[model samples]
Structure formats: structure tokens, C-alpha cells
Target: MAANALLKTQSPTFASPNSALDNIVLEYSISYFLIDLLHYLIFFPTDILFILHHLATLYVFLTCRYIIHHGAFAFFMLLILAEVTSLCQNIWTLAGFRRADLPAAAKLYEFLSPPFYALYTLVRGILGPLLVYKMVVFYLSGVAENLIPRWAWVSWMFVIITAILVSIVWVFDHWVDWFKGRNYKAAKKVV
Candidate 1:
């Protein structure tokens, strides 16, 4: 009985192209408007906080180098990155929610929720490998002028590159699915 219900729910016959397009446009427009307002208002204070925290960390790192060892330094950098990422993710989430983008909002909610907390854990876990990779690359490159080691900079560069690649791939994959007239698995599930 459950299988039958699932099959019925999953059936493409229930899906309406016009409705889906309307939903997408509506959600996008709402989110864009809300985010634009948030970008100007709430984000300004958040940005100031981030800047202050970053500057304070830099100042402490410079003046109190003797107190904080290499491991501690690495940990501090990771903390800062986590804070910044969290803030950005929150903004993204708010935009998604405001826009009524259910899937994106759901994903972000799951990421932030206590039961999952996957996004936070994933971000933290990635930092370790990133720090190591950056350290090695920076050491080889022979540039260590900033409070954050060259490794942190390199890791950030890699992160930006990966984000761009993933976004491109996602867009291409979605385009392919659209042209093929196939509902994505997630969208199918929604029906």
C-alpha cells in the first residue's frame, strides 16, 4: 500500500510544468527582493562584526605570538573561517526561505538543525585538510607575510575554485536534465 502511494506520488503525470515554473519564478523573485533588503540592512552590521573580529584576531596574533603556538594559531584561523562561513550560510538560508525555495531552504535547514548539523561538521572537517594543504603549498611558495599562514590563503583559493567548478557542473547537469525532460530525483520526490 505504501509502495503504491509512493509510486503515485512519484509519478511524473502529477507534475505540472507551468506550476513548477511559476513556483521557481515566484521564489526567486521573493528571495532576490528580501536578500537585497537584508544585504543593505542586516548584513551591514554582520559585516562590521566580522571585520572587527578579524582585525582583533590579527592584532592578537601579531602582538601575542609568544602566547599562541602553531597549533593554536591554526585552530584560531579555523575558528575565524567557521564563523565567517556560518554567517554567510545563514544569509543564504534566509534568502532561500524568504524566496520560498523549498529545496534550497530545506537543505540549509537540515544543515543547521541540531539533529543533523552536517554543514558545521563538514566545514570544520574540511578545515583540517585545507590547513594542511595550504601549509605545504605556502611553505613551498615562500610567502608568509600575513597573520594567517600562506597555507590558509592557498586553502581559500582552492575553496573558491572548487565552488565555481561545482556551481558550473550543477548548472550544466540541470540544463541536461531540462533538455531531456526528466524530473530530477528530488523534484520527483516532491510530487
Candidate 2:
């Protein structure tokens, strides 16, 4: 991604066409996001916000990958920002489901929670907005403005708004106690 940033500056047009890596990432995102949305229908029936989020994710990915492929370099940079927390979220979620009665698993889970939450906040909460700004302000302000159509921009705006609302709800419901310095206890059940 850093290399992509360099390329962005070097490109004669300031943003390059979508690369193979971008396509690969988009495909993976579409697959995983749809799978997650489906899983939420059964396992996390109450997590309606996340389900909606996943739907928005697929909408954005599919739209960008096929329908509107302009401003892709900038968009790819934003996608990389989104991926910064992938390892942390995956490890936290996967390890959270393990039997913490096992000493090793317990320690691993314990070790991951703080970093996971911190990284999640930084990448998703902070960087997500940066992505919106770049897409709307930088990308649109530049010559690539015509690359992304008005309807696509409108659709992306809706997705981003939904994402922000979901993030607010998620933080309040799940992370507020942590931020308030409440004592930690291993979750008896993991989702």
C-alpha cells in the first residue's frame, strides 16, 4: 500500500488503473463479506447492524469492481486502510471462540484483546473517515471526478453513512465498558 501511495504521486494521471492486487482484494472482500452476512442471519440474528454493514460492504465492492472502476487507485488505498485491522480482528474473533480454560489459549486471547481493540479503533474508526474524505474530497476534486459516476458516489455516501451509524452503535454496546475502565472478565460465551 505504501508503494501504491508512491505510485499515486508518480502516475502521470495522479491515480493509476486498478491493479491485479486490487481485484484480488476486492474478490476476497466480496466473498468474505457475503459469507459473514449469511452467517449473521443464523448465528448472530441480533447483530442486525453488522448484517447491514456486510451488505453495504458487498454493495460497494461489487459496484467498484465491475460497474465503476475509476479512481481505483485512491479507492484501493482506502481498502488497504480497511485491511490494517484484519489480522487483529481475525485473531481476536478466532481466539475468543477457543476454550480459555486451556492456559495457552487463555493467554493468547488475553494478549490479543487490547491490541485488537486499539487497532480496530484506529483503523476502522479513524482511517475509515480518512477514506471517505479522500474519496469525496481528493478523488472527486481531482481529474478522476468523472471516473466515478454521480449515482455511484451517492451509493457510496449511503454505505459510508450506514457504516458510521453502525460503528457508533457497536462502540456503545460493546466497547464503552472497556473505555470506562471496567474490569475484564473472559466472555463465558463467544460470538
Against the true structure, whose lDDT is highest? 2
Clash counts for all predictions: 1, 0
| TM values, all candidates | 0.24, 0.70
lDDT of the candidates, in the order given? 0.42, 0.66
Report the lDDT tens digits of candidate 2 across residue range 95-172: 777836566766787677777777777776777776676666654565556666677776776787568666756655
Q: Which portions of model 1 show Cα errors greater than 4 Å? A: 1-43, 46-49, 64-103, 110-112, 115-191
Kindly list the per-residue Cα lDDT of model 1 for residues 1-191, writing each as its tens digit. Answer: 21222233321221111133333333343344355545545656556534443443343333223322222333244445455455656765475465455766666654444322344434544554475456456545654433335454454445444443443454356446444543566677788
Positional deviation of residue 80's Cα in model 1 after best superposition, in angstroms: 8.8
List residue ranges in candidate 2 displaced over 4 A. Answer: 1-21, 98-108, 139-142, 179-191
Q: Which number leads on TM-score?
A: 2
